[model samples]
Target: MNAIGKTAIGLVFALLLSPARAADINAGKSRAAACMGCHGSAGVSNSGLFPSLAGQSRTYLEAQLKHFRSGERVNATMNAMAKDLKDEEIQNLAAYYAGLPGKSAGGDAKLAAAGKEKAAMCMGCHGNELRGNGQFPKLAGQHPDYIARQLTDFKSGARKAGPMNPLAQSLSEDDIKALAEYAGSLH
Candidate 1:
């Protein structure tokens, strides 16, 4: 290969090997100002109807935003919100949200314990701690109503094409309740 081509290839390798640049939290906070209404002051949604973003995995947030933007995940509000977001804004938003503290589900201890059995199914993807890895999302400390609604939506086909749909289809209402209660009780 030519010397110029080799140098260019070496530079590309160096770039690829370098750690990703740290996200700018200040920039993220600035961008997140627009998210405060439904997502609360720092991504902890005050309403049970909206899922909390605080302490969520950045990859999960990024994927969901992209999904909303691409029409794979369709929510009237989210679609609209995500449509105009640049990719960098999405990453910044994810970083900001992930840096904040998560809220509690506040379900009863017994119910949470019962739900732990149901949550076993979730362990495959959500991890043993239920905090989730990249792209799976944190179920720990999520709101009961939100979790139930999502499970119900998956069961009903309102939320389409996710692996959860099939799993949710197999869950009885009581199972859903127990799972939601359990997941919500986590820190």
Candidate 2:
């Protein structure tokens, strides 16, 4: 090969071997300031209405954010908020939130007990502790109200979360309440 062709091949090899860019937590924290209104400080939602983002899987968070950005996951506020975010910003935000500690909402003992019985089915996807696995979002420390709301949405076809729709459809109102209580009570 000529000198120019050799140099081009060498550059391509170098580019292919280069390490992927890492997420910047500091930048993420700065970007997340706008999200704190409802997502809470440090990604922990103070209210039961919003789902806590702290300690969630980065992959799951990124996917959800992208879905919202693309209008695939329909949420009025999220779609609007995520619309302007760049790919790097989403990665950084997911990394920042995933590094924080998780917290759970306490619930009635009886309700939690009932929910625990049904939670076994959830273990397959969410893991034994309900901390989530792969693309699934963490449920261990989520708020009961948020959990119930999402489940209800899935059941009613208001939310379209793949397997969750059919699974939620199988749950009764009481089952949702019980499961939310149980899932929320987890640490």
Candidate 3:
């Protein structure tokens, strides 16, 4: 190629390979307006159908958003929402949600105890009270019904998770319920 042609191609490649801009938390809030309906006004859903997003780890949120966008996880609503999300938007959204405080779910004492036992093995990855770590999400304040749905979906291969997939397969329905209850009981 001629020098001018090479220069033009180099510029195109540079633009294509350029790193994404830093996430804008303010812009994320605006983008998240559409998510408030199901996820909650501040990331806590009033209904049990959706998982709360407030106080979840940014890393976890980012990973899940990428998964939804890539179809590694299946959820019609999330897939569509994430499909057009830019990389910076994902980072910003995660930051915005992670910065909020999370509320815990309510559960029966007996059931919570049982769930604690069930969740004991998960502490290493999920953190104390299953509040989550860098790449894991906080579950302490999530709704029991939502937790149950997620666990069931993971167990049934409907969600298609990496660690949760096989781990859930080893648990019975009752175990899943107990775990969800325990997680819900945590604040």
Best by lDDT: 2
Q: What is the model-wide C-alpha lDDT for candidate 2?
A: 0.92
Pick the winner on TM-score between candidates 1 and 3.
1
Task: Write the residue-wise lDDT of candidate 2 on 1-187 in tens digits.
Answer: 9999999999999999999899999999999999999988978787788899999999999999999999999889999999999999999999999999988778878999999999999999998889988799899888899999999999999999789999999999999999999989996
Candidate 3 structure quality by residue, lDDT tens digits, 85-117: 888899999989988889877887898899898
Candidate 1: segments with Cα more than 4 A from true spot: 1-8
lDDT of 1: 0.86
Q: What is the lDDT for 184 in model 3?
A: 84
- lDDT (C-alpha, whole model) for all candidates: 0.86, 0.92, 0.89
- Over 136-176, each residue of candidate 1 has an lDDT whose tens digit, in order, gives 88888888888899989999999875698899999999998
Model 3: how far residue 169 lies from native, Å: 1.8
Q: Which regions of candidate 2 fall more than 4 Å away from where they truly are? A: 1-16
Q: lDDT (0-100) at residue 105 of candidate 2?
A: 73
Query: What TM-score against the true fold does each predicted structure earn?
Result: 0.91, 0.91, 0.85
